[model samples]
Every structure is written in structure tokens, then in C-alpha cells.
Target: MHVENSLTHYCIPCDETVCCACVSSRHAQHQTADLVEYIKQKKIDISKHKIQIAAEHLPQLTKELEVLKQAKEVYQISADKVTSKAQERAELMKQVIDLVLDSQLSEIQKVKDRDLDTFIFRENEICFQIEDMKKIVADENGGENAESESDFNIISAEREMKQKLESFSISERSRPLPPKFIQGIDDMIPEISRLLGKVERVGEIDGGVTQRKSAAEVKVQIMNTVSCAKPGHKVTSICQTSSNDVIVAYNTQKSIDFIDRNGRKLKAKKLQFETQDITMNKKGDLFLTVNDSSLIYKMKTPGNPTQLYNGGPYKALGLCAQKNGNLAAALWKQEEGIIAIINSGGKLTETISYDRTGNKLFKKPYRICENSNGDLIVTDSALKTVTGVDPRRHRRFQYNGGTEAKNFIPIGVACDSSARIIVSNWKGNSVHLLTSDGEFFRFILSSRENVTYPHALSIDSLHRLWIAQKEKVVIVKYLK
Candidate 1:
């Protein structure tokens, strides 16, 4: 019985409440010498009772620790949420205060403006009434002496009122222009002041904000035809002058005529050239390009054309004012080919030579114009294509519609007011409309009848498409 008791289970390290047979056989040669020495040295080791106690209370300790950890996490999360909410509240309050202050400031400004308007109106009225009194005094100076004195007094009062009104011009009541009154300057002052006070009172808030407002719908009216035109002559180009008169470049049976918009031909004493293309600069001057001539003629006013360059035979196709205030000309010759550049002191400024595929710039450059992006658009009739070149002369619009002339013989080209390219096809006997990016969009032709040949095209401010039929010798206007 004693030997069997010694073989029962016991923790050997504690060295307590184990029979000699258990301690001597199992724990005698253990690998942990410190545990074995502790077991041997302790007077009261808990080896026998440790397992029993841990088995009884481990589940409760585990549950209590889990509860403590969960509580700690919940508390931290709640604190963070409260901080965020407080910040949001603070921001909202700040915005509200600012809006209120701004609205109040706007109202105050409106009130001040109204007061100023009223004061000006009253002052003007008083001045006019005093003027009437002065007129009465002037008319009745030979009456009774007392009445004369009274009229003089009235005149003095009127003069004083007139002086005061003159000090404040009636133009003050006119519209206050632009950003100065965009937010009702007076109304914003109070709102901004309020925001200055309530900045931190509001809690955590996102600084990003959104505002939406409706804008006024502006109505614009346009006229399709020239409002008032000359009765008999064919007007090639019309330029409106700063003096409210249109300088018209017109053509009669014999010579090109210059006239005002009212049809009265201006006395152009110096301009004695028959020109095909005419233009006007902003300074109300004339620029005419004669057929088969290299020089561009400049008429500083309504007078005879003066040759810009006498070294002729270099046929300048088109002339336009560049952004740099220098004149740009497209000059073409068989040897020189086609080149466009700014003319500074009769010298070329920039030159571009090749297409994207390293081909020559133009076979026979006919006309050139500037597009919306300030690019020079040139029409090469021999190549049967239109090309857009940058200021640096790099080819941008290499519009190659095959080598076939029937599909792409662009003769007359003009840009409409909406930036749509209108090109008259010499071979096709039709017109092609191209988008600003040089993409072919649509065809403009009278489907009812095939016109013989469309020569030149132009677009007026009203977006009307005008085609000059050389064979017909008549200019026809078409709907857009």
C-alpha cells in the first residue's frame, strides 16, 4: 500500500506532500537544478494544491480580464468620437457666424448705397429748382425793389445748390463695376467680424465648403445681313472704326472703291491700285493686296494705297496683324516656295519649312490666315491641302485628303465667326466645313443645283457664309 501511494501524481518541483517513492524516483534526477533545489529547500511548497486551485478559478480570471480590456477599448473610442463631434460643432458654428455677419454687412452696405443715391437725387433736384428761380430772377429784374432782392436771394440759393451738385457728379448713381460689389462689400464686413469672435467656439470641422449661386442670363441679338450697306458697289471687306463709321472696301466695274457704311464714297486720293484682297487694322487704315504683286499696299487712311515693299514679284498671298503687333505676310514664289513670317523692318522674323513627313511647306501657297489658337493656316493649292503651322513653323495640321484633286482641291478658304473653316473646293464645285482642329465636318452646297465654280469665301460678324462665284460674278449668302 505505501509503495502504490508513492507512485501517485505530484509536481516534483514544489517537493511537498509527495511520498518518498515519488520524490526519490521521479524528481531526484531532474534537468532544472534550481527548481530541484527550491523543491528540496522549501518548508511549505504548494505543488500538491497548485493544480487544484488553478483548475477552480482560471475561468473567472479569464472572464474578468476580457471585461477590463473591452471596457478600456470602449472608453477610448467614446473619447475620440466626442472630440471629433466637438470639433465639427465648432466649425459649423464658425461658418454660421460668418454667414450671418456677412449678410448683415451686405445689408448695411446696401443701406449706405441707398442713402447716397437718395442724397444725390435730392441734390440734383434742388439744383434744378434753384436754376428755375435764377431764370425767373433774370427775367424779372425790373420789378419792385423788394421783389428784385428776393429774386437775387433765390438766384444765390440756386447757385449754391448747383455748386454742391456739381461737386458730386450724377454719374455716381451708375452701376458699380465688377468685383468691388460682388459680395455686397458692406454685408461681408459684419459676417467676417462675427467669425473672428466664434473661431474656436465651434468643434472639429472640415474646412472645405461649397457654394452655389445662379447667374444672370444675358440675352444677345445678332443680325444676319449688314445693317446698312451701300446700294450699288460690291463690298469686299468692312471694318468698323472707333468713330462709329464702317470703312468699306468696295469694288465697282472699274476700280476698288472705299466708302463709309452709309454708301458715301470717301475721297481716296492716294489709293490708285486694283486689288483683290483688302483689310483694315484697328487704327482705321486700309491694307490691300493686289493680284500677282509681291508688295502689300498700306493706305493709312481713306486715300491712295502706298506700297509697303517695292521689291515686287514675290506675290504676297495674305496679310494679317500678329499678336506681337508686327505684320505677318505669306509670300510665295516658285523658287522660294511658300513662307510666312513677321515683317520687322522689311525682314523675315521666323520661318518653318517642312511638313510632318519632311516635305516642303507649300507647292503653291495661295492664302494664309490665323486661327483661334494664333496658328498660321495656309492653303496650298498645288498640294491640294490646308496646313496649320505653329509660330515656330512646325506643321500641325497635315490635312492630306489623298493625292486626288477631286476630293481636296481647296481654292478659297475663310474662317467663320464661330471658328469653323469654310473652304471652297475648285474640283468638287462644293464647299467643305472643317472644325477648328482641321477635322472635316460637313459639306455646304446647294443640293438643288450644282454650282459651276465657287471662288472665294468670307464670313461676316453675323455668321453669314458668303461665296464669291467668279463665273457667275455674283456674291451669294448662305445659311450656316
Candidate 2:
């Protein structure tokens, strides 16, 4: 019974050693190898697997378990610390709230007690008056000699009763009941809870994850200086027409001069009264504010100026045309001024004297302009700030040029086609660019050689900024 005859062949599919007779019978279709060779290959594979489990798999799994245990400990410690801190803060807040609640309750109770005592005292005084009247009536009802005594006593009692009644009437009519206590905790508790939740969320967030936005950058440089008005005539205000023509208002000359882009005089009109400010309407007609007068004049080319609107009590100073065919005028009533919005039909539409919060919007409005969004931009000379008013006649925002505009004294304001507000600060000797909402965007021009006292500002159809200074007008091409 040799081993080769007994179980020599190893059937790979059945994983069993078989004899030659078994291979011929049940294992005929199976792949078979010699038993000794199969055992030797399996031994080598098992040895390699054992080395991998001992050297790599087991050691790696043990290291991972140790790391997980350490992480669990760290997490537990952190959670405990956070919980302790939150509890401490909550306890402190509760103590503070309790103290405030107790103090408020004590004050309210004192008020209630005082009021109740006053009411009780008043009731006792009323009862005492009733008893005195009853005694006077009883004495008057007695017989014979009581008649004469009662007559004298009745007159005196009647006089005293009338005085008491008058005092009681006053008290009954004038005395007010105590105010009822209102619990505001119902409204405040939700807000406080929301704030606490926000605090917790903020604590969880990393401070390094926040990103900041960069400020808008703008560069402005002067293009050239051009004499747009007559020599020795002061330019009070400036505006641009649709055809790129600039209209300059001369207060001393009482005239408006239309000049081309190159400072060549194209057309000139002599106004009856001295003009303070000039603006152009949609039809290219000029609206001029008569200085020290409550009248605004509308002038067309080759036609005499006609009275556009009567400002009545307000004296028109600076004027601008709105997109809706209305006129916004900076009018001075007395010491304080207002921005008046008048319709094209010479009717006063609205007046902005005070803000929605009932605060004075302007002390002395010098220049006025309407933005593309129907907002009125005005430079308040007395306040030294540029103020914006919305179409609904509410004060939007005010800009005093912050620290960047040193010694700011805004005198003129204009809005460009891009909705950017241009303000000229005469005292500061600088021109500032602001957003439509009256935020200071940048400094467009600063006084230097040849540029002093920038008084008026206007942006033309070509986006060129025309600055009216004393004696000379500086034109700058500002790229937003």
C-alpha cells in the first residue's frame, strides 16, 4: 500500500487528496496535481499571510485603536470645558437678570403702594365731607329756637359744602389712574435666546475662516483748464446739455453762457435778475434761480426768459432738473433752508425741510442735483456736508467727507450719468466723489497750483468733469 497508489493526486476543485482509482471515478473532470507539490505551495502562501498579519495588519490596527482612544479623551475634555464655560456664563447672566428683575419689581411695587395710599386718603377725605353735611342737616331740622339757629348754621354749611364740592369735582376730573404693569419678557426672551445660540455657533467657528472685501479704488487726474465764461465774471454754477455743451452761470453778470467742449462761447443769454444756479431741462431749456428772489426762470434759445415757478416763502438758490421733468431747488426760507421739488406746470410738488425722523435735514442748502434714481443730492454749507433725499422725501444719508476730506465745507453738488455724486468743498479746497447714497467714494480733485476754491461741479455727456473754480474752470476726465 504505497502512498502513490493510496492518495497521490490532489483534486484542486474538491480540495482533497485522491487515489488513482478515485480520479478515474468521481474526480475524472477535476484539475489535479501531485499531493506533495500542492502541500508545499500552500505552506509558502500561509507563511507569507502569517508574516503580513503579524508585521503590518495587527500593528497598524493597534496603532489606529490607540489614536482613536486619545481622540476620544481629547474630545471629552473639550466638551467638558465648553459645557463648564457655558454653564458659568448662563449662571452669571441669570444672576444679573434676577437682580434687575428684583429691582424693577421693587420699584413697581413701591409705585403701586404709593398710588393706593393716595386713593385711600382721597376716599377718607370724601367720607368726612359727607358726615359734616349730615350733621349740618340734622341741626337745621330741630324745632322753635332751632329755626333761627338752624337758619344761620344752614347758610354757613351751604357755603362750606359748595367749596368742598368744587374741590371734589376737580379731583374727580383731574386725577388719573395708575399705569398698568407690562411684562416685556415675552418679547425679549426669544431675542436673548437667539443671541445665545449665535454665541454658541460663533464659538464653534474658527476666526481664520473669515474673508474681508477690498475697498473700491479710483484714480482721478486733471485733463485741462479752460476759460468757459467771460473774463472777470465769477462762475456760480455749471451744468451740461445733451449735446455736450456746458452752461456756465455768472452771478455778477446776471447771464448764462453756453460754451463748447473747447471753451468756445456758443450762445449767451442775459437774464433780467442775477442768477445763482443754472440747470438744463430735457428740452435743452435752461432753468435759472434768481438770486435773493423766490422766482425760477425758464429760458429757451432765441426766446425771452419766462417765470417758471414762484417759490413763495422760500428763496431759490441752487436748481437742478429731474428726469421726471420736475425741478429740484435748494431754497432758503430764513436761517434754515429746504429742497423744493416743483413740477413742470409751475406747481410745487413737495418740499424736503425735515427728515422722516423729524430732524432738520439742511441748515443752508447751497447746491442741488437729482440722481438717476430720483434722489436729490444737496450740499449743505452750514452743516458742511452733502445730504441725499430719496424720492419719497426722506433723508437717505449724509456725508461730511470723513477724515479724508480735511476741513470740508461742501458748497456744490452734482450727480453724473453713472449716478456718482460729485461734491465741491470750497473751504477744504477739494472735490470729493460720493456714491448715490451719499457715501464718500474718493477725492476727485485737491487744490494745487492753478486750482483754488473749487466751487461748482458738473459731469458732461462725454463723462468729463467740469470744475468751476475762481477765475478759471478746471476740466478733469475721471474714470470710475
Candidate 3:
């Protein structure tokens, strides 16, 4: 409780003022003094504190202020330099704009003149025809010479009319469309990309850069690239013999080319049979599948290809030699998909049609390969899936990419010695690796590595990858 006593005392030990009633209660044990005398002593202490502050702290604060001003002046100089550089850039940009304008204007004037000349010529020709026809009509309509015209004049006039009619032609050139103003940033990405290059901060400190997940990384080396430069030829399928020689199949050109790992062209031949797939068997003989059930084979010599077997009425697309020396072919029977296994003696042994759940294995299976473990790997283009089949002709696993698979249209399938499968994603523009059990493991190739629109895939005996691009093939050395 506070007292309203006008008289107060200074409790020196507590450094507080107290009323008479309070000095006798809460501060009864503290030493006390007169309030007026304590005020006079405090005023003296304040004077001494001001003198200390002016001597020590004030000079230090002034020095700090001067340092701040100097640092700000340095920043101001740099700012001035930046402003000057920007002005210079602006002047250069204006000059370039003027040059571009002049070039575009000249092209426009040329097109305009050409179009106007053609239009004027056509108009004058039509005008002359109209005037000649009108004069003949006027003369025939009794313009003072209708009754007096002789037979020679009439015959000559008729011949002239026939000549004009026969020679009349309104030749039309392909219409020239008005030029459209194309927006260019330059392809800002293209020709002049190096001109006004990117401006970025120098000596940027790296902060928490992202690393690709180890699970999503698989290293592969590109050994060589074999370019298929034959005009009108497109790569369809690829196969490698046990000796690491590559055979590239092309459809439009009706050709199969042979090349080594060094990209040297060994030989090429235009095949007599329409080839849907090509592969070499255990005897180093080539097996060629036509669009139908006909299978053609040839010895190492490029002689006349012999039709090995013709299974009736089925469309065959892709086939591969199995570990057991049998040939497994993807056949279309009655608009359905079947993998037919042919014995070494060129007779149909078994056909796999459905999975364990009675689900159709494939809608349209095109490319096929057999793993070292006798698991037949097939790429179903219509279903966009890569399926694995065991030696028993039973469906083992089917993969269409996982949840992370984007636009996953699988095109090519290859198996290595480890039974690992590689599938090329056409729409995704990437190549993916799969575990032996048909699970998506990681991406081994992508568009960033120039693996765009990849189609055919094959693995040689050395476990190297031969990937076919649009017009070229690359032999890549696979890593773990």
C-alpha cells in the first residue's frame, strides 16, 4: 500500500523514496537520508557520466559513421558503372534492331513486287481477251459491217476465235501467303544464343544443390555410333550375333546391314523377304520373320534365302532364338496375340496365349528377345508393356512402368547376361532398366544423352548395348 504523505525520506541502500509510514514498515532496517540532499548528489553523478560518454563513446561512434559513409561510396561507384554499361547495351540493341528491320523490310518489298507483277500481267492478259471478244460481238451485232462481211472475213474471224480459245490459259501459281510475324526468343536457344548470352552472378555460393537419387542412376558408356545414312531407310530392329557383330534391320529400304563394334560397314544386302525382325541363331545363321508366319533363314553366305517354315494364317512380327535352340515368335492369330515356340526342326511346339489369370498376354507384340536365363522378353507395342516368359511358356511378369512412369510407351527390350532387362520408352524419350523380376529399377538413358525416339535395342555377347536412334545406331558399354 502506498501512503499519500507529502513528506518523504530517501532510503539510500534501496535507492528509493519512501513515505514516513512506509520507512517504518517495508524499509524499516534500511539506512535513510534527507530527500533534498540525495537529489543534489544524484545531479553531480549525472554530470560526471555525461563527461565520460563524450570522451570515450562519442569519438568511437563518429569513427563508425565515417566508415559507413566510405563503404556506401564504394557501392555507389559500382552502381554508376552498372548504369553506364546498361546504357551502352541499350545503344547496341538499337543498332541491331535497325539492322533487323531493314532486312525484314527488304524481304517484304521483294515479295510485294513479285506478287504485284504477276497480278498485273494476269489482269492485262484477261483485259486484252475481253476487248477482242467485245469487238467481235459488236461487229456481229450490226455495227455497220454485219450485212457486208464476206466469207473470207468470216472464215478468218472464226479461225482467229478458235486460236484464241485454244491458246487461252489462266496459269495459276501456288498462292503466296502473307508472311506471318513469327515470335522468336531465337530457338533465344539458337543461332544468336551466343550473342546476348546469359547474365548470371559470378562466384555464386552453392547452397543445397540437388543430387539424383542413387536408385534412379545407372551409368552407361557410349562406345561408338553407327550412322544409317542410306536414303529412304529407317531402322526397325537390331540384333547381335554371339560374335558381337551387329545386324541392323531397315524396312522401307528392305535391307539388313551388318557392321562391327567399330562402326565399320562389314556388308549390307537388300533382302528378298519382307523383314519384321532379324536375329542370328546358335549356328550363326540369320533368322528373318516376314509380316506373316513365313520364316526365312540363310547361311553365313548371302545366297538365295530359303523359306524355313510357314505356319498357316497367322501374322508374325517379332521372334528370337531361345536358350534351348528353339525359336519363339510373336504371332497374331484371329486378332489375338500368341508367342509360338518352334522346335529346332522347324515345327510349332507350343504357343503361349494367356497369363495365369486368363488375361491376354499381349494385344500386339512386336519385338522379342530371350534372356540368358531362358526368360523370353517381349515388348508389346499396343499394350506398352514388357513381358517376361519362362522356359515353360508360362507368363512370368508384365511391366508397364510404375507410378513414376510418364508417357511410358515401351518400344525396345534387351536382356543382358545378368538377366537384367532394358526397355526404351518412346513417348518418354528415355531408356529404363528393369530387374530380373520385371520391376522398374532406374533410367539408364534419356533425351539429355541424345537418346531421343529410341526404337531398336540389342545386347552383344560382351553385354554392350546397341541402341538405334532415328538415323543412327550407338554401341554403348553398360556399367552397373
Report the alpha-carbon TM-score of model 3 versus the true structure.
Answer: 0.53
| Candidate 2 Cα errors over 4 Å, as ranges | 1-219, 229-232, 404-406
Rank ordering of all candidates by lDDT, starting from the highest: 2, 3, 1
Query: For residues 1-480, what per-residue lDDT tens digits would candidate 3 score against the true structure?
Result: 556464468876454678787778887766666677768876886676557556755776697678778877976797687778767776787799799999998998898889888778878888998887788678668656536678898799789878987766664553455656676765645644455444443321111113332223545778888888565456778988667778888766667788886778898877776567777787777777764554545446456567766755677778787655778888766657878777766756567777777888888887888875567888887787888987556888989876435577887888875568888888777887777788766667777786778888988767788887877888888654
Candidate 2 residue-wise lDDT, 1-480, digit = tens: 437559988886465789988888888866677788878987996787567546745765687679778877977898898888778878888898899999988998888888898878878887887787687568656543642556778798689868866765434544547767677887787866764443343221111122221122335667778775557777888888868888888777767777888777788777787888888888888888888888999888658889988776878899888866888888887678987777887766566788767899998899988886667888888888888887667888989877644688888887876577888778877777676667656666675434578888888777888888865688887764
Name the candidate, 1 or 2, with the larger TM-score value: 2
Q: List the residue pairs that clash in candidate 2.
A: none
What lDDT tens digits, residue by residue, belong to model 1 across residues 1-480?
Answer: 456444343442242344555456765542223334545544344543456447645875687678778877976797787788767776987788799889978987887888778777777876886787677667557454553357788899679867865754446446343223346677877765564443232221111112211111111122222322344544333333434443434333225433343335564433455455565555666566665667777776645666764324577665655534556566677755556454534444444557657878777776566664556777777778888786446787756543234566776677654455767776666666666667665555532235446555555444445454442222334432
Local distance difference test scores for all models: 0.55, 0.76, 0.73
Q: Once model 3 is optimally superposed onto the true structure by TM-score, how far is the C-alpha of residue 7 displaced, in angstroms?
A: 99
Error of 2 at 17 (Å): 99
Q: What is candidate 2's CA lDDT for residue 303?
A: 82
Error of 2 at 269 (Å): 2.0
Worst 10-residue lDDT window for candidate 2 reads 205-214
Q: Which segments of model 3 are wrong by more than 4 Å?
A: 1-218, 291-302, 403-406
Better of 1 and 2 by lDDT: 2
* Minimal lDDT window, size 10, model 3: 203-212
